[model samples]
Target: MKTSVILNQENLGSVLSNVKAPTYDRDKVTTSIVHIGVGNFHRSHEAYYTNELMEHFGVLDCGICGIGLLDYDRKIYNILKDQDGLYTLMIKELDGTYTAKVIGSIVEFIFAPENPFAVIEKIAHPDIKIVSLTITEGGYNLNEATGKFDFSNPVIIEDMKNPMSPKSVFGYLTQALKLRMERGVGGITIQSCDNIQGNGDVAKKALTNYVKEAAPELLSWIEENVSFPNAMVDRITPVTVAADKEILKEEFLIEDQWPVVCEPFIQWVIEDDFKAGRPAWEKVGAQFVENVVPFENMKLRLLNAGHSLLGMLGALHGYNTIDEAANDPDFEQFLKDFMDVEVTPTLGDLGDINLDKYKKSLIDRFQNIYIKDLISRICLESSAKIPIFLLPTLKQQLRNDGEITRAAFVVAAWCKYNDGVDENGNTYEIKDAMSDTLIRAAALSHKDPIAFLKIEAVFGELVNNKRFVETFTNTLNMLRINSVKLCVQKINSSSTSV
Candidate 1:
């Protein structure tokens, strides 16, 4: 048996010979970015990239000061704090091999709830050039129907009332920007690494709208001083499980409290616009594009939508993880058809990206046996995901009279999955922000077939579309009688793309 060493700065030298540890001097690194919502994805993607830049390109100025803004963030905050902001990043390769790297980019972590002022002060610091966020799609606090900042949120209301003692992300950002303006600090970029399309633009609107109401004086300063640049980020990072920890301790001889595991593939396509300055991340593999829309569209439509398709259908079929469902021949075929028939036409110009190769790679990635991406993780906050990832392709298909069968089936699968019981009669918790509403509508679908679709917040005008309604209704009815697996096979074998 190998000797196990706790993963921290002190034990970095004692780690297994194969494990890659940060070679840079930790004390010499300084924070140029204050990142909010330091979750698995943030650690696995943005922090990983920054660590590479520092390690390979000698970019020490771009070190990150991680901020945890949520109550759930306390867990990670404690872990990273204990380990001195050091954690293992286990990359599960497609060939079923593992590569371990100790990431040291997150030089410090601040739990916002402990001292909100400390968090604000860090963002306001002159050395901080970028305030980055990985606060998921729903965290933006947007009115889903209006596609704008929601002032009606109780948290937003409370933050607006007591600006100094703020709770929400925007409130903290606004207060920090106010301080920055007062201190004559130069402009900074607010970079959003969320999966939302035009994420930076959304961040700009949400922050500016909040500033417009809460601190009208800061609006002009923000307009001139702040920049929000859109980015397209891609990686398959699953939540860390106990087995991952065991593997680290037993196989790698590293004891990590919270280590992140992900697929080897990673991509970051950022808009080439930054106000203050940015790390030479392009030296490390990040693509800096003039426009990220074309790339963003390809990812959101193909990769993201494909994940949702597998997740919803996989859950209903009683599969516990994405790989389990993706490895199924029937499910694999359905995903390919969905990508080729329904989603492809929606993507107009992808510049030079080969759609066929991209789609094939997506299938291969999903079926990676080493990356045990939980179905529940993919299904989590799906109400927010479906609208942003899958709905646009669906709307485009409806307008062009293209293939709607696969997309409609995925919606039906979502309705069925929300019932909180799979075909095997095993109950699982429906994890979503709109869980109650979704379950209620899904339960009502048994009697009123269109009840789920009538959820105006989710389906919107799609409920009014007769062809979509008929197809969705039929699929939902078929699902009620047949197994999810059977329905998938039928959809795959179907002659028409109706």
Candidate 2:
């Protein structure tokens, strides 16, 4: 097969020119990993890392075959197809180190909406070793309150009724795995790159449940053969805007269909449990750990938690991006105190990365002006994010009966944001799907204060935990009186007062 796009080696050099190579041509690449949801994050982080694997380490068996589980992903598939599966990843560094590297890790791109059977066939291909995902937290079709598969969801029902027309990613993955087992293809690693607790395990459970309900044989087979490796992936990647496109055009001198812009900081820690042969990803700077729980806790509690706090606070304070939030002295101090006092105590010591270093990196990443990670992007799905990022610390504080003033501040801020208005009294569109439900819930809670605590979907059964409920009620009352800003000030004053 002929290559689609040509890059001039003379002008851009051999190192720079091979970014747009076609994957279907067997001569140019070897397919080892299949990645679902080839969005900006996967393109910038995973694909860039793989490109480095080929360039620096000389390990050439890894190439990504991109698969999309949604109709919206078709545009990205076409963009990558036109460029022969190459796109530039612009990594914005805080220390004045800017890089624009074209990555060619993905050789073939297919959209499940238009080509569902093709995706299933590709998954059952003998040579494909790793099946990875970057589908967001909500993509797994999990219940926000229960942290498990919501079998009652309409999509789940559709998938159960029509397995061949599998709508959700979870259903499609199960169907594909069934094909692999039936066709006698060996086991493959199911690696999840989403930012959820036990992400890989969650993926395993969801896929397993779907198989068990729809096809018991596949579930049994997966339990015996498939290996789901838990991982922690971190990088601040924002949705690409028109101005971002203009920046890419000026910097790289090429028009990319879906260019990714991200902060320089990126980390991937995986549990070494692949059943099949895998890529030497460590050669490309991936970390393999015996247990990833400590690392996961640190990232989830401090970094992820702080990001959520800052995002809501920033939006309330009339800021667009994280850098703007970092610039506010009050917001910056609030974040520092929240991490230092409340979040740090909850984190039971990470191996090499202690609380100090982790806290510093959180502030530094937030302060990186070049990345422009929008506060609005992080503000979505507070109902989902609060449990993973904020609830753990809250639960821990309650157990210890420790001073949780700052933690209360975050809860109050979320409640305030849930009111669906900014500090300026200007109403912005609430971007969450549960906006109407949450708004009514919060308003009703304001009527009786403790009444809102009854909504277990958002608060979970933890609302009955007396210590947590007491601190939370006090903090919410303070917020309503002095506003979120003053509530944060009081908490920081009491928690970290020197």
Candidate 3:
């Protein structure tokens, strides 16, 4: 596996000859953004956009400085740091073509766990104008029941007691803001690239609440200064397995520890309300809008929620990949039916989108063979995802007195999948933040049929709603009685009335 083409700063000349490298010199780019939780999604989505911004329009100052906060991030931090914050990014276009580039947008990376003090100082630095996050949906530390920051959580409680020495993101953010206040640096936007609806509001609420009790003065300062802009970020980036690493080594002769592979399609709709300055992302196809809600809703409900629908039902049908599931006639019809009948009716406020065309695009995205997006990856954190991506659809449908049979079926499939077994008795491990509780409830639901809904953290008010309960129970019973294909047909046919 040894190769002459090592992926480092010095090999830029050689790497450029093999594949695309940054057109702008690496030394010219300055860091203006400090992104927390710099995972693969961030690399392929936000980082790629920033690189485009620089390459296309010479917007070099907005380069990102990636920071790793959790203990698990130590390994990634070292890997990226060793490579001098350089890595390969390969985008697989839907039509069988590909684009490969060494992304140099991330000018620096700090392993924050190694030195929290230094990390805080870096975040508070005047050059860092924006603080973004791709910390996943669960990383916000919000309590599922209240939808607010869970101060009662141990890490929050610890941070509340000892504000100087902290643990969670809230603590670090509060401390950084405090330092910024003392240093007289202007406010910076805290953008959330996570999958939450109104993520800006969620971030503001969580950060402000944490500081409100711990340091009221900081809360006041935050209220006057900070901005959390809601954003809708999309790109299908799967986990990089060993085979992906080998593709880089053998095909490109570039030995990179963490190279990102993703779909060519990318979109970022951000609200232009940065307290400090922001990048000219619009020059490179990013939309800086007045309201991101419509876009967020469209993407979350249609794209994300539809992905969840495909995921569990796909897993149950013995199809592992999204391509496999989305290609199947029955599953595709079921997907279109769910999106059109249950989801579209609730999404009237999406402006002028051709609903049918958008739905078709979604199916095409799902069926992209190169991405090979795992239904399991889409299925991860269902307890968190259901409420964020799917439950809103359920709530809206119930409010409008609309049909929710397929929507109910989607939730029921999740409950069945939570049992850790597919229809063929092929057991797969359940992975979720609420796995312990959800897995136990999934087992109990086989007998009780309503036990899964009782997990108030995930289900919220829907747990006690009689109408939803009855409909959900019917769907679960139908799954147990009939084959998955038959049920898909029922869902598509509208024969299984609510």
Candidate 4:
């Protein structure tokens, strides 16, 4: 296996010995979707599904044309372009078996920052029916208090004035749609794959509010023609680090520049509300339903909320990976109780889901020894995760008069973790968008546990509520004084008894 054998269209036949190459003919495929912010999750999940559909159902028109918006996306574009948009998807199973396949669903890569006009032209093309996004939750420029587009965002301010030179995803979307309208192209569906509740609606409101002043008539046409379908996407794809490349080479003899490694499970539940049309994605294991709210509720409360519970705790206790944290008896039991008691009561009826079984399955997935998902990565963008993943359940729990001690504990541990010092005096650098303010608030929290909650941008009015304040104060004190391990054991002791 020589390194000279590059992974591209010319070498596809040669690499079939090690990598399960796509069976569909690449030349026949046509781009139907333009995916912005083509990151690891989009590759492992959506591209994987499109490949599956093309191979089995001969659906080649929905092939993805991946677009990179930010300057950092240049690295992805160059690497993927060199490989002809082909990459290996490695899946690790619990039984020590793994699968490797070279996915070729992404037929093209467009770097928007370098050439925004060409990218917009492609999106505005009549053939491209859907413009999807995997931009992170914060990428939407949402105001935390109102859950709407933040018009005050500097990028939004710039884009509104000069839509032609768009900087943000919203800019690209608006400019492309404007071109479509001018060119007499019919409507297109804008799908949001970010982990926000009612994601389609969120993107819809953001786009609707954004274009109102700039193009009022276009706004009217968009309101009538465009459709944003709410969707829930799930997968535990870890970041592809340097070591993963060596592993791929050793195990599969494939020298992929950026291969994605994930657990053996993946799911996408989407609302069937596309205005123009959509891929028969259900043919490839994607569920097209009338409403995705129940699935969203189940995932947000059970899986995402579970991560918020353990990510900071794992870092505080010096665990490196999610499995290490979940494998611990104390942390494992705490998650069970947290889900069964605190989180489950906040969820609506999730039809056909045995929640107890689902909870156990989450434990299994989190404990997948082969995935090696980094807790530090999970802790990335903590300020954003707090509101999107945890606070919804907290607000609901307060309204329903449900148990919130565990939820409060999660927030408290996050605050303690932000202090940059663990119980053993070992130090860490605080990593967050509001690190300076959070660290200052965390320092004051030692004396005043309510200090962190006073930041209205993050905690809102929850600080004034006596119930939340008292609970959070007690948990913060416990995390600061005792070892995180002991505090977790104490919390589990009560949970396990119940």
* Candidate 4 residue 13 C-alpha distance from true site, Å: 0.6
Q: What ranking emerges by TM-score with the best candidate at the front?
A: 1, 3, 4, 2
lDDT of each: 0.91, 0.77, 0.86, 0.85
TM-score of each: 0.98, 0.92, 0.97, 0.96
lDDT of residue 243 for candidate 1: 93
lDDT of 3 by residue, 2-55 (tens): 454778888777763658888788898888999999989999988988998888
Query: Which residue pairs clash within candidate 3?
Result: none
| lDDT order of candidates, top first | 1, 3, 4, 2
* lDDT, model 4: 0.85
lDDT of 1 by residue, 364-466 (tens): 9999988989999999899899999998998899899888998989999999999999888899998888899999999999999899998876778888899
The residue-by-residue lDDT of candidate 4 on 174-233, one tens digit each, is: 788888888889999999998888889889888877788667778977987788998999
Candidate 4 has which clashing residue pairs, if any?
Answer: none
Please identify model 2 stretches exceeding 4 Å from their true place: 1-27, 95-97, 496-498
Every candidate's CA RMSD? 1.1, 3.7, 1.7, 1.9
The candidate scoring highest on TM-score is: 1
Off by over 4 Å in 1: none
lDDT of 1: 0.91
How does residue 93 of candidate 3 score in lDDT? 79
